[model samples]
Target: MTTHPLLQALLPLVDDLSRELAEDERYRRLLGTLRALIPCDATALLRLDGEQLIPLAVDGLSPDTLGRRFAIAEHPRFAALLAQRTPTRFAADSELPDPYDGLVEEHVGHLEVHDCLGCPLFIDDRPWGLLTLDSLVPGSFAQNDLDNLEAFARLAAAAVKANQRLLGLARQAEAEQQLAARFREVAGQAGRAELIGQSAAHKRLLAEIDTVAGSDLTVLIEGETGVGKELVAQAIHARSPRARKLLVSINCAALPDQLVESELFGHVRGAFTGASGERSGKFELADGGTLLLDEVGELPLAVQAKLLRVLQSGQLQRLGSDREHRVDVRILAATNRDLAEEVRAGRFRADLYHRLSVYPLVVPPLRERGRDVLLLAGHFLEQSRARLHLRGLRLGGEAQAALLAHDWPGNVRELEHLLGRAALKALARQAERPRILSLEACDLDLAGTAAAAASSVVVAAEPPSAPLNGDLRQALDAYQRQLIQAALTRNADNWAATARELGVDRANLHRLAVRLGLK
Candidate 1:
């Protein structure tokens, strides 16, 4: 005894409900099986995203149809199909404009659909999306075909349900990992990055991170210098399903123009003068994980194009090699520069900028975090105390007041260094280490150090008196040189220390120094 043909066509979909599959693959298989059973010129599976219907898979239609979005209000045919739960077949002379007009493959010059059959898929008794089949021949779908489609629609809904359940399980696992990591951090594990704030701005940033971490969308983190943009990236990676994999970072601004491409996409042996051995770049190293492109705005135009290619195609080639290597990498880019302004100025690629900023996140500056400064200060103080091997370390009354009053131009990094310095100064004033060392306002020296550091101009340009002397660009360069020179002197010519003092990434500082001829 043989089972029915329709049941045979649907058996694979039932088998799929027990197995894991990519969402697109599942949808594609569903459409393929449906077309095999019911002949049609075109078919598509669309998922409802708000008021828009996004095509997840399409068959016998123009390839571009997968990219086209149909609004429910704009397409009356789609609206009619979604109005009911069961199958609906439109008449040959239906007055409504078909969304697929001029979209059927190989059919030239505005081919109008004559027959259209669609079933609104329901999950938990609510409208989820629609499955549609189109034919150029009129009266192509009969009552039996409609019944067959209605039966298939139930299996389609089950496939969607299974996909959703699998996704939920993955997210649940990632969430569990995030919670465990947080618990470990609170239990005094070292080297773990923490957000460390309770202010509204900080809370909002955390919420945004939580919302975007489950998916593989590229996130562009934008903020001022030392605003903990990298910390935000870490939080995102830690909460994602890729948390178990490595989280690699490359400072784009640190490398020279010639080396940036090699550092990102890698090179084969003897690819260049210095290429002695085959080396995998950050993209390859970060396979099945995350890559944080620090100072991504500083990437050169040529490198930007290649990077965009990798992102768009998920395929890359090493330098001087014809072979393409496929990688699965989730990108998290952080930049202190205004990338949109850079794009307008022709300094950054607009296409790359748009791709990277699919989910833009802005980290709030420390000044906007209100009393979270004190909390962060306390966190740093404990770390300082641990390093100094002191019994206890706490801020004095005046120190707390001074911290609240002053504007933190350098952001969190500045506060951290200030606390460390203040702790040392307070310790030196005593003959022996006290049981609890309290840092006073005088120990901070906020006013004096900030003013002196702000006034450095060792290379001798036009003084502050001549504000508009020479070109505006030259004046800006002169000021930047002065600032870098001063910070270098204060940091004992340590580029890394100077970067922290100036609240910039060390690689970014190096790029600025080179551009300003101060390197």
Candidate 2:
């Protein structure tokens, strides 16, 4: 007994339904099977997420397609497809514009009126998402094809459901759900502040965050500047038991040395020359909550002693007052500097470093996270689109290539700022507000930026000209100081870039800089 062609295609997915395949692998195999049966030029399975449709899997499309978020309101064709219950095939000459213009693989220019078919998937009798197929040839998908796609759509929904169940079985699912819900709430009210990535480095970071968030252990988040360490802290607090309580943060580097003690442990009237009245410090304000000591490496040795005492006893006195107040606060410290090296250099106290680094979390730099850069770029592009009130914004093929090729020294924050600037540049190039503005390589100018950065490194790497007049070690130290100082000036005091230019590890550079009094 021979089975139907659609049924043959779906049997493998049925097997996949019970297997322990990764979520991405399951979705990819589902799309692969759909393309094999349908013989379409492009196919995608997009999951409906509130007002937007996010691509879960794509076949015969650009890799960056998975990063894009298609808003139903912006794409009329998608809007119309979801409005119906059965599969939809647009007319060859349909006046509605296609959303996948210039997005079909190996096809240059915009996609014109052609064969477009979509089937809306439903789970538990509610709208879930859309299964779409596209081809350059008109009249390619006949009525029979639509019916076959409808069958495939049902199996696709099953695959999605299986993935959901697998996620639910995992112990981390509840925490992830809460995090997602909090993300949605905060995104609706203000700018979005959720981690967006699918790379292995990002997954490792997420696993670590999940592991440490459930406990009250002190966490030292160490990462380069602009790597979103504060976001990591927020994620920990959002997933922790003290989520409902306040998560206060103070920048140690922003305060004067004399005020550091008062800021963290509170101050009373007449404590200092500028002390006007009694005030609650960050620890008091964040009592029974979480407090983030940003730039913790910048704390003076004197203040570090007091902070260590408070961390040890949970008791602190207002400056110039003998009275003590007990509070329960969880400490989360962040720093771009290597505190261990600082301790070795006699700058940071070894005991205080030990107290703060109960569990250290290192955020991988942006250069190490591969395709995650595109996902993050998409996130930022969406934000720019909404802020600038543009109809739509997307990256051209060359622009994506540029982004992928560059080494992101500044990490996620750099990518966000770059996309924001590129969108505006692309918008200005258009004669009028385009329906879908595409950013080209020229708009990004990443190549030019890289060239400039390279030139600066060359200038900063030159050997010092001034002759030395002391012992061998003294001469070497003077030369090192000159090289580091020049690099720092050229790189605008970015220690990471300076380290890179000098061909030394960032931690080693910091230790050397401190020893030479160049910090």
Best by TM-score: 2
Q: Estimate each model's TM-score.
A: 0.56, 0.80
| Candidate 1 ranges with C-alpha deviation above 4 Å | 1-190, 456-460, 464-519
Q: In candidate 1, what are the lDDT values of residues 48-103, reduced to their tens digit?
A: 75566767788987543553456587678789888887899997998876777555
Q: Report residue 482 deviation for candidate 1 (angstroms).
A: 14
* TM-score (C-alpha, index-matched) for candidate 1: 0.56
Which segments of model 2 are wrong by more than 4 Å? Answer: 48-52, 69-99, 111-116, 125-128, 135-142, 169-175, 179-192, 268-278, 451-519
RMSD of 1: 24.1
The residue-by-residue lDDT of candidate 2 on 364-453, one tens digit each, is: 988889988888887677678768876556777888888887777667887888888888888887798887678899998775555443
| RMSD of each predicted structure | 24.1, 6.6
